[model samples]
Each structure stands twice: as C-alpha cells, then as structure tokens.
Target: MQPPLPGPAMILHRRVVLSAALAAPPLAAPTLAQAPAPTEAPRTLPARLLPVPRSVSAELQHRIAAPYPANWDHIPPDTAGWRALQAASAAEVDPLLPGLIEALRITVTPTTIAGVPAFDIAPRDMRPDRQGRLLVHLHGGGYVLYPGRAGAGEAMLMAGFAGFRCLSVDYRMPPDHPFPAALDDAIAAWRAVTAQHDPRRLGLFGSSAGGGLLLATLLRARAEGLPPPAAIAPGTPWCDLAGEGDSVNANAYVDNVLVSRTGWLGAAAALYAAGRDLRDPLLSPVNGDLSGFPPAILTSGTRDLLLSDTVRAHRRLRRAGVVADLQVLEGQSHAQFLDPTVPEAREAFNEIGDFLARYLGT
Candidate 1:
C-alpha cells in the first residue's frame, strides 16, 4: 500500500519525523580503511599552446603569424652598442616614413620647444573642428631608441588620421643622458606647447615607453602646479618597470614584439632607471597617484606583453574617480595597434580621435 502524503503539520512535527527516522536503517560510522584520502590543491597551471586568432583582420593575423624578432635575445653590452642598436632600428623604421607621410597628406617640420627638439606635424587638410586643438606626442623606444625624426612617425600618423596638429618631443635618451633627461625634455615641451595653445583644447598620447612618459609628464605637471590636458591616450604603456604585471610572464613568448622582459626590455629598464628605484612614480607612473589625471583612453592587445600594465593604469585611474576607458584588441602584441596599414590601427586612432573630440574644447 502507498504511504500517506505528508501534510504541513506532519512535516513540521518533530515526533513524526523521529518515528520515520527510527524505522530507517542507521548510517554506519566511516571506517579508517574506507575513508577518502585528502587531496592537495594544484599549485601551478599547465603550459598552453595558443594559435593565431582568426577573429582579427587578415593583416593583423599575418603580423601575428610572423616570427619573433631575431635580435630579441641581444642585450647591448655598453653605450656604444646601445647606440648602434638604436641606429639600426631607426634605419629600418625611418625609410618607411616618407611614404607614410606622403600618403597621409601630412607635413613634419623639425622645431624646438623650450630648447627641446621636437617635430611639428600637421595635416594638409585639417578638420574645421580640430583647427584649434593640439596634441603632444612622445615616441616609444624603451628610453634608448627612436631618437630625432625616427620617432616622428607616430606623430605624423596621428596628425593625418586624427586631423590635429601634433608636437612630437624628440626627448633625449640614455647612455649620454638618462633618467631625468627624457622627463625634463617632455616637461619642457609641454610647458612650451601649453603656453602657446589652450590647455583645455590639448591632449597627450603615446605608446609603450612613450605612453609611460606621457603619464609621468602628467604626474610631474601636477606636482609643479602646471595645467593638465583635456584628455590622454596611452596605448600599451610600459608603466611598470618593476615587472610586477601578470602579462609580463603570461604573454612572454606569446607576444611577437616584446617577447619577454628578460630580454633587452629588462636591460633597457635598468639603463633607464640608472640605479634609481624602479617604483619611483616618475620611472613607473602606475605606482603614482592618479587622483587628478585627465580623462584617459588606454589601448592594449590580448597578446601584448604589457597588457597588465595598461589594465592596471586604467583601474588606478577609475579608482581615483577619473574617467578612464580601456580598449583591448583581439590577438595583438605590443604596439601592433600602431601599425598604419591595418584596419585595427585606423580603428584605434579613430577611437582616440573620438575620445579627444569628446573632451577637448573648441
């Protein structure tokens, strides 16, 4: 026969429950021989093999498939070696500038801003809305490379794409000058530019090491009571010289450009630091207070070695109650967003342009 269904009163009754429990077989105590063994948690993750993602543009995919740089493992032995390396790198990049400049319909003129050498880039056909807006650019080369005109390519690209007049600071680098020299030059340029242009209509941008310097410049400006820009775009910024970011190791070999910090990147950091503390706010702006920084739009890639640096900087800005936007592209490494030919590159510049337009005044 079927048992009676439990009513609310029967279910709530402790005596009825006890009677039912008494009719059931009691559970036997666990024996030592049958006890489950304790399991220790795994301490490490297994290595993963990742393939080039098909989601990105074909051009970007091709870049992702390219082999790592041959000189990725070479560390400069001395100042001369570093200079030679810089020259070699500049040689490879400089030749491409003429075509890019011509195609982009921009002109680059060498000039001095407060005694610091700089490049003035202007689009031939400037947009009406951007006529009074100005942008300061700092070129990236790990603080030892891309001196003089070689560093102006990024400025030219921005001038052409973003349609804003750009001042690219040809900041002094290490071996001959180190530490404060680059920062000093950048500050000098900013002072000169801000004196001429309305700070409310000005913006700052850079990638990698230059991005780090851009943030540092803002910090230094705040300390000196200088006016801040309206907005900033720091893409894939190498803001943590201490190598404390997770992507530094996670994306080591995965990043085609900056393969790992253990390579020349670490050496470059040491050279730039020049015995100073890596965590110094100027040296590594991620550690600095970002309470009053201007609105920032940061960009990074899924495969960028400094992805964590950019992410950390974005989080810090947001935590400080600053308006911050972060864009992480799929399957990119290092400053691949700066590649002029790729659609993603154009998209990146367009996003920065939009952000600047939103913040900068007429």
Candidate 2:
C-alpha cells in the first residue's frame, strides 16, 4: 500500500517526460534524390523581352546590372560580411591567373607590333606554324579595379588555343586616371605590339569594360585612319551606361552583384570619364559607328546582363556589313571563357579558338 501511494507522483512525472519525447521526432536523413545537381547558371535571354537590334553596336534592350542567379545556391552570399570572403576568393583567383598563364607554354619576348605606337611589346609563346595571327588584348575590371594582369592569364590560355601571340596591355587604372586613359593605354599597347607587324596579322580581344573598349578603340582608330584589325572578339561587353536595357529593370532582383545600377561599373564610368557622358561614343563604344570596324566574334552567356550588349554589338556589326559571329551559351556568366576552371568557360574558349582560327587564317 505504501509503495503504491508513493508511485503516483513519480509515475506521472515519468509519463509526462515520455509524452514530450514522443511529440518530437529525430532529424531525418536527406534523400538521395535530394542531391544537388551540378550548378550551371543559365545565361539570361528572355526572348519575349529581348531588345530590338539597333544599327549602332546592338543597343541594349535594357541595361542590366550583373546577371541574376536562378536560385539561392547560385547566388553569391551577403556581401556585407564578405570582405574576407572576397579577399580569400581573390587569393584563390589570383594564383590561378598566374598558373594558367604560366601553363600556356608561351615564351614571352620583346617584340614590336605593327600599327601600335613605338612603345614596348610583350610577346607570348605561340607556335611559329601559326605565326601570322596576333592578339591585342584589353584587360577588364571596370576601369579602376583591374590592370592588364587582369586578363593576361586568360589571354595566354587563349593564345595557346588560337595559336597566336598575346600582346596584353597593363593599362593605367582609375583615381590617378580616367576614361581615355585606359583607351589610350589600350591603343598604345596595341600599337606597340603591332609595330613592324602587318595589319592582316592582327586581332583584337577584350571582355566586360575591356570589351567595350575594344569597340571604342576600333571606332577611334577608324576615325583617325589607323590600320584595321583582321578581327575583333568582344566577350560579354558592357557598352552602355544610360541604363536603357530590358535586363536592367527585369534582372534587377536576380542579379546578385554589381550591375548597371549601383554596381562598380557606374562608379568606374564616372571616374573614367572624369564626369563625361557615359553614353559618349568613346565612353560607351556602343554609340560609335560600326562602319570600317573589322570582322568580329561576340560571345555572351544567357545569364550575363551584358548579353544584350553583345547581341546588340554583333547585330550592329552585321548590319554594317562587318563579318560578325555571335555565340550565345546556355548557362554562362560574363566572360566565362576567362574562367577556365568552369566547364562552360572551357567550352567557350574552345569555341573562341575555332572562331579565331577561322578569322585569323581564312
């Protein structure tokens, strides 16, 4: 009787604890089917909203910021707390740049280019068998953040593929400089490399702002009666600042990083122009006449905010009777070819090789 009387309180406490435990289940294992697919960011090209192609280097249907991410996984994390992240990412990225360049099997030399100024020239390793073609490259990163080293690695890699020498320019950057500074340096680099060389041996290449500069350089050269390049390849060029493209508004939410809106480019353009109109033909390049520009190969990704820029540029070159080849990748980012680690980038570079091979030779 004493045992039974004492048990009720303890029994009730035990029952209560058991009931609470049963109410919540242990964590379940994720299903095999839930495994994430290898992420492939799609290049954004909303067919319904694509801008009408204009006669001037294809005008953007709308200005876009950066291309957008389709999902949270694809999007970059909060930049607010990512300085360390950015630095670390840059650390990882920087090494690869050099490694890629060194791996190019190029033997750099001091060789003068034709049509370029009487300045220095840096020769990259290229097969003598494919000796005639040359690459004049402009590096990207708005106009402030990057240097010629910015894209030299990509150039070296591409040089191997195209069997051409890269005369990459280490142009002056912002703060100490502005708009025409980079353009001037780029043209000088081109001229320096082309000195004593033939125009038929020349090619022009750039990405992002550098790509836009390639167009501007061509326009300036044509205006000044400089020798024409055999071909031009502007990859994912950012050629506008009036913010007049469909992607600018439509892609606002999806693009994760800097854009035509508040991104780094607007600032770069301002500093580059030293307060000049961003739409100035020398500033935007898209505003320049397409006539007498050399044949071109324009490449862009579906998600690239600059896809419209590439499209517009290609279409304009075509309308002007310039030989233009436009390649649109399914899921690519800006200048994906510059990133050989990415599968899409490798694929893009391979395609670029084919394009350059055809244009430079035939």
lDDT of 2 at 171: 67
On a 0 to 1 TM-score scale, where does candidate 1 land against the true structure? 0.88
For residues 1-362, could you state the per-residue lDDT of candidate 1 as single tens digits?
12266555645576545654555535253234432355544236678877888898999989999999998979999999988988887898888888989999999999999999999999998899898898999999899888889998888888888898999999999978899999999998898888888899999999999999999999999999889999999989989999999999888899999899989999999999999999999999999999999999999999999999999999999999999999999999999988987899989999988998899999
Local accuracy of candidate 2 as per-residue lDDT tens digits, 120-218: 223364466566676777766665544324335556666655566667666665566567777786667655555656877778887887788888888
Which 10 residues in a row give candidate 2 its minimum summed lDDT?
55-64
Model 2 / residue 264 / CA error / Å? 1.9
RMSD of 2: 19.4
RMSD per model, one decimal: 10.7, 19.4
